[model samples]
Target: MIKQGLLVRAAVPACVLTGGAVAGGVSPIAWATGLVFGLALVLLTGWGLQRTGRGEFGPADWITFARATLVGCAAELIADGGHPHAWLVGLIAVALLLDGVDGQVARRTGTSSEFGARFDMEVDAFLILLMCVQVAETAGLWVLAIGLMRYAFVAASWAMPWLTAPLYPSMARKTVAAVQGVVLVVAVAGILPVLWTVAAVVLALASLVWSFGRDVVWLARTRVPAARPSAIVAITRRRAAPHHGPTWPAHNQAA
Candidate 1:
């Protein structure tokens, strides 16, 4: 059980600073600024609301939250027109690397909870969105499909309630999620030309579309009128059990 107070308290200051970071800018890149600050605020507030009760916040959450902060910073840098540097790449690479650490910390230390699971997933989704903004700078908006896929799925769920159903564990889904960050990071770091970056993002988007599509079709076929979430669901507030899988945030179980 997660107590609501902890996250809200800890996140308020960082969020305020992040807001000022957005407002103080002379001319922040529109897409970049909105993507970074918007996602950061959503993550902080959404996850804060999900956390409740009297559970220990745990080491894993701290690590994951730190990574999320770094992602917000990366987005801010892009908004300010700071070209990508080895240091920025390194920072994001660290965030990606630390993704695995949170899950492990939760499982081994027996600190896993629904809140932790959602926290991890939100961080992953937001970070992907931020990186997508950078990749789009060179690879075109087509590349954004990869980062936006998760959010798009969530939005569709609002209209199609069956899409909110918990999905079965799939290694393919986890692999696809992890690969998106690496490919986009590579593209953003200027490791690939625009052609390769767009091509790679397209492939990744296709895989994501396929994975989510399959899940949707399955949900449609097996829709249980009773078990369905509200039509207007809290997309990030999934009550999933924690899983120690290759995916940074894996598992599907109601709180």
Candidate 2:
């Protein structure tokens, strides 16, 4: 029933976006891409909810869902394959602004959970990636690094599980992550000169690299070492040792 509700809720936006695209005379390919994105979003969200044993979407999850829908529309615009339209920029801006909002909603509504946080983060990452694809057309391919960095880290975590360890909260990390979206939006908006846009993207990428590098280093440093057989045996012995009074000085020892 919950999944059925989710599908019903998701279909509204999907249809609206598709209808808008078609009405605006967007290419079939672009609207089709939006549908594909919407479908994937629903499937993934449902899978995540099932994995986390969540039966209903929280208030913040709904906000994130709205943001995801906007992103899907933006993807359609970006897929149209030209300079971003004013509407595209507006959609992304709203999505980015809502990024902060969902968290606040989650916290205030007491619906915050691991699943919600991960869901928000993935949406943010995807929006950044979608913008990168748009900006890269003009800003150069290097701009892609800013978007792909998080994904690369995720892929690396598969090989080095330590990379998946939770990171301590840092304002700098959050600020850098936020900057990527803002900068990409500006770049895609074409508000700045070509050179300036490229430069802004470069700085965003650098900050992202620094933030991720710091996290990687911290994860590496804090990772628990796997115990060897000898180490395990020694630890077990220490744990199993019987407690006794402290040893007396040699002079006081019994003969």
Candidate 3:
């Protein structure tokens, strides 16, 4: 079953790349970049799945894989950057819409896993980054910071291992993550007046700053020094054990 999911993952990017090239007749280089990006996502995700213990791709995973394909296609369109078509915007809109559906499907289907949740988040981040790049031409380079902040945080983790600490989930973090994609897509699509677009983007960035700032402070306060791999494993195991709390009725619960 996992193999089937992997095959579907492979096919999606191939079809997207070929279809985009033939349909748009745009820059081959940009198409190639999108293909590479899509393939890389699939490969990286395969590794993540391995880390999740063992399970085949569930319905939610397939849906997210499809969403990731749309993100890759949108990235290609943004790379060429001639004019943003309604269709490219439409594609992104669908991807954003699907974000909500996957979680519900995961919970309903009882197949949620650490890998699935992380997969969804990484997809969200990449989409925001792609859209940020798309909007930067009109909104200015500062807009790129919205997308780059997550990557920046990851890089900072290298110098401060404390930054690598897992945060207790917050609704604020999820809300900010969702908002980043929406405002950036609006900004990229040029759907509003310049003033409104700028305002929305600014608001999005502010929320992001607040969200990340909160996480950083939390991680810093909670971080413990890891002197050994065994210590790290113990920390992870402790974190992974279930908490006593009310559980939701569904296939799986969203964090």
Candidates 1 and 2, the one with greater lDDT: 2
Kindly report which residue stretches of model 2 are placed more than 4 angstroms away from their true locations once superposed.
1-4, 224-255
lDDT per residue for candidate 2 within 153-251, as digits (tens), equals 989988997666555546778899878878888888989999888888889888888888877775575452343335334433443466575233332
Ranking by lDDT: 2, 3, 1
Q: List runs of model 1 lying over 4 Å from the truth.
A: 1-56, 224-255
Which window of 10 residues has the lowest lDDT sum in candidate 1?
246-255
Candidate 3 Cα errors over 4 Å, as ranges: 224-255
Could you tell me the TM-score of candidate 2? 0.84
Write model 1 residue lDDT over 124-171, tens digit each, in one string: 897888788877877778777778888998899899886766665568
Evaluated against the true structure, the overall lDDT of model 1 is: 0.67
> How much lDDT does each candidate structure score?
0.67, 0.78, 0.78
Each candidate's TM vs. the true structure?
0.73, 0.84, 0.82
The CA lDDT at 166 in model 3 is: 56
Model 2 worst lDDT window (10 residues) = 246-255
Q: How close to the true structure is residue 89 of candidate 2, measured as C-alpha lDDT? A: 85
In candidate 1, residue 235 scores what lDDT? 28
